[model samples]
Each structure stands twice: as structure tokens, then as C-alpha cells.
Target: MTTTATTAKDLFLTAMDRRFAPEVGQGDLSLALAGAELLDLLGARALTLDGDRVVPGAAAALGDVLLDEASAALVRQPPYEQVEDWLWRRGRDLAAAYRRALQADGGLSARRSGRLGLGAVRVEPVDSPARERAAARLEAAEPVLGALAAAIGIGIAADTEAGQAAVPAAAALEDEPVTTVLAAVMDAVMELEAVRRRRSIEEAAFANIWRAP
Candidate 1:
């Protein structure tokens, strides 16, 4: 595959904003961690020597991010390259599902293969090969998204509890543990930001590269 110089960064960003960040509640910490996982998936895909097989190491690594213990075990049993392909296909299907769900919820508007709407969201071509390749990345993201959402939910719950609690200062901080807990929250936020930056740079570079006469 001929990877354009900016594809990694560009796609990373798009995935972050259009998919990952919202799940993480738009925090920098969440984004950074998520970005790590996202980059790992993309990197694994980029390293495939055989298009037909899963790279075991890559699959295992990415699998750790996407699946819990039982699911991870199943992913590890397959040939690495094949597993990679499977994950990619799975992600693509899930991504399409996610998009459809979003449209249904009215979180997104219907559009074809270009930027549209007030937010300048670049809608991926529904049936494009690029989406096929992106599927694995999206699939891998499923777990991460769930984890991030859960973590934020926990955080929000804690905040609500803290607000409701009438306690001494020490007791309140101890019960909430916002300082320690916020670390994970922040990690999620940062991962999203990194992905966003990576995508923007990549998209701009891709345009410039392709436009050169």
C-alpha cells in the first residue's frame, strides 16, 4: 500500500474527533491515552508485510487495547496477520454501525464523500476501500471507547456524590479522590487532542502533496 506521508496523522485526527473524543467527553487526558491506542492500531496496519495475514504481534498488541481478557484470548489464537485483517473488518463494520446509530440519533447529518454541514465534518465514503482499511482501527477502538465512557461516567458520578455530600474538607477529598482519579480522566482527554492534531496535520499535508503539479 502506498501510504501518503500524512495519512497516519490525518486519519488519527479524524478518528479522534469524529469518533473517539466524544466518547471520552472532550478532555485532553482521555484523548492522549486513546490516541496511543489509535496510533498503535494504525501502526500495526501500516506494518503488514502480507496483506492477507494478521501480524501476530501487532494483532496481540492491538487486541489488548480492544478486548477484555476472554476476548483478547480469542484474538491471540489466530494468525497475526489474519487476526489483523479480522479486527480491521470488524472495526469497519462496527464503525458503519456506529455512524448509522449516530445518524439515527440525529448527532450527525447524512452526507456523501466530502466535508459537509456546519461542523465541516469530513464524512468517509461509506463503501470506500479506505473505510475497509479503517475498519480494524475502528473495531479496536470499541473497547477503548467503552472504557473511556465508563471512566468519565465514574468521574461524573464521583463529582455528583461530592456535591451531594456534606462532609469535612478532608473527608470530602478523601471520598471523592478527584485528584488521583482525574489522572486517568486527563489521560483520556490528552489522547483525543493528540489524535486531533495528528489528523489535521495529515489532512493538510495530504492535500498539499496531492496538489503539487
Candidate 2:
């Protein structure tokens, strides 16, 4: 299938657009986007990981601003840092940056609405074919492509059968460490989502803690 997605961010967003609700929480998608960025860097040979530490590879610009920024950050660092620390701190921002980039690229469309005098905005795919092609690519089952599809499927919809089917293929990727780190990143994303859910519940409880007696 032909696709416009030349980078991991494009594929990640495309997958989200295809499978998730239009109003999916930004925090949840952000975690996936961050994982996509890391995967792109690793795929491009612009970065590498030493054990749990991410190391800079050859200096090269990915052209995409968010990717370039990530590459530059890795290069500026001494040599390496724990993957967990770097991912947790940088993932959300990277996701936001990619969203902006998507808007500029005309791959995403924004909509505005109001209900009961309250305003809301949301983003969705501008072109359906882009996402369809991305989904087809995910099913291609090539080493890198399959690994990516599995990692992303796990991150966003591990409870679903599709996600489960993608899992075993991840082990077949040439870089075993990449699969390991990708799993770690997915775990971090799940952790962040859990935290968000807890925070929301806590806030709701607090808001109703002192009801009118």
C-alpha cells in the first residue's frame, strides 16, 4: 500500500486515527507518539542504546523538526542516560511537537464545536487513505515494520486481539535490544496512562468530597 508516512510519527498518528476515537485523550496518544519518535531514531541509525542508556549515533538531520530536535538532544548528551528517565521526561513534549508538525503537514484536521456555551476542539485525519495505507503497512509483517506495529499495538490496545497477534513477531526483529527497549517504553506509557486515570479519579472524588448536607 502506498503511504505518505515516511517516519514513525506519521505511522503512529495514522494508527491512532484509524483505531481510536476522535476524542481520544492527548496524554494517551502522546505516550505513543513519544515511542514512535524513539523508534524512528533507532530505525534511522541516528541513535542507539547501550544497555538501558540511549547513545547518539551518526549526526544526521531527519528533516522533521521534532525528530531533529530529539537527534540533537541525544548528540548533546555526554554519551548515554537511562532509557526510562529520558523517555519519561521527553515523551509528552515530543508528542505535542509531532502534533504541531502534523498540522503543518496537512495530515491532520482540526474541528471546533460548542455545547451548552462551552467550546471544544479536536483533531482528526484529513485524508483517510493515509491511515488505511499505514494500517496495511502494519500488517506487512516485515521485521522492522512488524516490530513497530506490535509495539504500537501493545501501547494503545493491548487488550484487543490484534494487539496480541502482533506480539510474537516483535521478537523476530534484528535488534533484540530495540525490542527490549520498546517494551520498556510501552510499559512507561501504560504507567503514565494509569497515573492519569488515578489523577482524574482523585480529582473527581475531591470535587464531591464535601457534598451539600
Q: Write down the TM-score of every candidate.
A: 0.24, 0.73
Which residues of candidate 1, in runs, are more than 4 Å off? Answer: 1-172, 175-179
What lDDT tens digits, residue by residue, belong to model 2 across residues 1-213? Answer: 112355465555554464543344455456555556677788788877778777878888676677777777663467567777767666656556666777777767777656653566666667666656665555543445555444445233566665565556565566766775667766876787789789999999988877746
Deviation from native of the Cα of residue 132 in model 1, angstroms? 41
In order, the Cα lDDT scores of the candidates are: 0.36, 0.62
Find the candidate with the highest TM-score and give its number: 2
lDDT of 1 at 40: 42
C-alpha positional error of residue 177 in candidate 1 after TM-score superposition, expressed in Å:
6.3
* Candidate 1 structure quality by residue, lDDT tens digits, 17-136: 443334323233223333333334434442322333423343343323232221243334444434323433343323343344334433334454335545644433243344444433
| Candidate 2 residue spans exceeding 4 A from truth | 1-7, 15-23, 112-119, 128-130, 141-165, 204-209
